[model samples]
Target: MLEGHQLLGFGFFVIGLWHLFNHTKLHALGSKSYTSTLWFPTTISRYMELHFIMASCTIFIAMELFIAPIHHQPFDPDGTIPTTHLHNFEHSSMAMSFLVYAIFAIVLDMKCTMAQHELTHFLGAIAFTQQFLLIHLHSRDHVGPEGQYHLLLQLLITVSLATTLMGIGFPKSFLVCFVRSVSIVFQGVWLMIMGFLLWTPGFQPKGCFMHLEETEEYVVKCSDDEALHRAVSLVNILFSFLVIGVTVFAMSFYLVMLRRYGGKVEYVSLVKEEHYREEDGFVKPKGTIDLENNMDDDESQKKSMQE
Candidate 1:
């Protein structure tokens, strides 16, 4: 289970990084030309991102529903859901929602209708919403130190959900894309951290330890109420530091890309010329000026000299 959380975290981190780089590059090149996309196309394949999402979600669903179960099944002899597997079912449902989103995204992209992008964004929003709901209403513990981590994770998911919904209406807004990507990165990082902190004895809080249950899952247990409080406080502190660190890193990355691509002579000159033209309330037509004709006119006599 720890490995699974880490794997999912790494996948999210990679996707988030990919989006962060692409979106920043687009904005740095020129905001006017920067249109938000739900996913980036890969050089190897246009559907690579969607394919990745579909594949990962399928694997996760299989893990939660089949491979990880005690008897290779989620249901008991009476066809009743075992209490131990409730969380697994909830997680699989979350993955299934993402799988649906990915399938619909590919279909919408292929259709190439006027509202395709908007519909894709709406689908993405729905997937995030499903993820938020599942995690928010998880059947597992939600009051312990581990729960604190999940609570913070839900906050990040909310940001992702909100930004995805906003993308439908503001598909041209780079800020929305930027925030959404960062939130995903945060979620990935936090999940990995939670997995390590809660599962690894070395990383657990001073007075906290992992307790194995009949469900074959390890839970975080603190020695006393004070220890539990201290552990939760530490999690909050870690979250604050994570926010600061990620923000600085994101802004620094943006500046670097801006300096490398945003300063191109053509882009700068075009933007400057457009600004001046708009200010002067006039636009010069594209063509060569008739200098010879102007030089032969009466208005040129005052500026011309005969040798």
Candidate 2:
């Protein structure tokens, strides 16, 4: 769960930064209302999305390969899977999926031109889809507030997937981008809540108790109806917090964009010819020539001939 939270929190944070830098223009920020477009101002800026994803995936891979091995044995020496390693294996698999997408995105960025952004969007959706499935499949056995939290997280992951798909179809839609960013932010916040509430000493659900054996991590189980109610209320409060956090981040980002690029002209690709220059080429050449120069040249030629 901690790994899940950290992965999602950092991934979305990077993505939020990418969207702020790449997909947005300061001109719209300064306006009372602005629409978003899919293109970025510069070629390098256009690849920020992939860079963030790749970086996040690298971190996940590192965590899985180095950090995780220290804590959990993912497989038995005989090559049989253990019940204890199920969670670890699931997380590792999810990380691998992100790594795959990141590598694919980087390759596309370097070698491919058409549908690169669209493909990235699809890949992102696939990554989220993997998480969504894991949460659904794994949480079925969880019975208490922990289960509820996983269910909520699954919903957010679903939204993340949906928004990514929508982004692929309507890459220019500002609303889609905004929703996607907010969804991710919400996921991160919820992950933090889960980490604190489920694992921390003080924040466990009111009606539930955690049991830990010598060989296993703690598992939460509900003890009474009243505790369940308290846990549900706590979840409700956490959701309210998520909403507030997203609102604050969005507003702050808007203000920052407005202040930065508000007055500048829209940035264009340096490689492409300007529209005005193309239009200039269509103008007809003048019919009036340098008749005086032509006459003088003619007279000089005739004088030479006579001489």
Candidate 3:
């Protein structure tokens, strides 16, 4: 399970980073012509992002449902579901939602309908909603420092969900897309942190220790109430630091990309052309003839003719 969290975290981080770069580049290159997309096209394949989502979700679902269970299945020998595997089923269901989203996004993109983008955004919103609900109502108990981590995680998921919905309506809003991407990246980072802090004995809180349960899961237990309070407070402090770090990273990335692409002469020239047309009632051509010089030459010729 620890490995799974880490793997999923890495996957989310990659995808989020990919989106962060693409969206920033898109806006930087041409904010006026910007339109939001649920997924970005790649040089290798137009559907690379969607295909990745589908493939990852499929493999994750398989791992949660089939491979991770003690009996190699989630069900008991008597054909009933085992309580120990309930969380696995819940996780598989979340993956299935994303799989559905990816499949439909591809279909809509290929069809090229007028509402394709909106539909794609809607599907993405649905996927986020499913993820939020699953994590909020997780089958396992989330308490102590772990609970604090998950509680903070839910806030990030909510930001993702809200922004995805906003994307459907304000597809041109770079702010909405930026926030959504950042939230996803933060979620991945937090998940990896949780896996390390909760599962790794070395990283456990100062007063907390890992306790192995009958279900083969390690739980964090504090030495006393004071220690539990301290652990929870430490988790909050970590969350604040993460937020600051991610914000700085995001802004720095945007500034770099904006410098590289946003100030291009092509986009600047377009703006200049529009300004000239608006002020002069026509676009001023490059290297235009000088009317003042022409007038002066004509006057000289007239004076010479008079002489």
Candidate 4:
């Protein structure tokens, strides 16, 4: 039952979660060298992560442009666009923006040319902004539980856009990166939730059902208020679990890296600090303390002889 959109979301989820560790460090076996970019074992592993995002965008483009269109006519014969067609068009445009971002990002990584990190962030912001606008516009057709879900998704998209824009403004802020990654992961998870809850039958909102008319396909409405409330409550619980689970997993990965790589880094740094201090005469070098003691005894013997 996994359709293109759901699969796309899962892909984005994995990729977004991967970005959560963009700053992780890993210890090299039997070496003091520590690094976080070991996914591809390349110096450009960070760029690889960005490239994966780009690839995900491409998949979205493919689904919207090539696959989804085949199932439904994008435009009526008279050239008027239906709501569904408009939604598809909006989705494709957003994916295009992401594709543009990925290209610019690769350029920035490889050549250090036009549109640096800030520009990349700007591109990401624009892409998510498109999604936010589209979701808001498309949500007009939906009401009740489905509408509420769309509203929540739009809020997330807005947060994602804000995070990217903030990243552009505060390029050096680690918090911005953290929030951005979380937002992206949340988007993916929400997409999957929407697919299972709204698209699938068994997990449909309580007392709510889907109508499959071609023009009205993928719409869910509630017949009983109580059942709908219960379903919504269940959704909230599941969503909370998802948030906690993903957060915990990300933190676990970070802690593992810290133990393996960060600890060694600290040890190496301490050794270097001591060596520098000794060189600067602030701290005596190893074995130099014994030599100094011997020198003091010799000086006392000479003083006694002089006496």
Deviation from native of the Cα of residue 160 in model 3, angstroms: 0.3
Query: Candidate 4, residues 164-246: lDDT per residue as tens digits?
Result: 77776565555566666676778888888787777788778658787765765566767777877876676677677877886
Model 1 lDDT tens row, 1-307 = 6765776787788889889999999998889988999898989999998899899888888888899887889998999998889988998888888899899988888888888888888888888898899888888877778889989999999999999889888889999999999999988898888878887777898898888888777788989999999999999999999999999989998899899888566445866886788899976578957565777795667667552
Q: TM-score for each prediction?
A: 0.84, 0.71, 0.84, 0.72
Off by over 4 Å in 3: 264-307
Error of 1 at 210 (Å): 1.2
lDDT score for candidate 1 against the true structure = 0.87
Clashes of 1: 0
- Show pairs that collide, candidate 3: none
- Model 2 regions more than 4 Å off: 1-4, 26-52, 58-72, 213-215, 264-307
Report the candidate with higher TM-score, 1 versus 4: 1
Judged by lDDT, which candidate is best?
A: 1
Ranking by lDDT: 1, 3, 2, 4
lDDT of each: 0.87, 0.69, 0.86, 0.67
Show the lowest summed lDDT stretch of 10 residues, model 3: 263-272
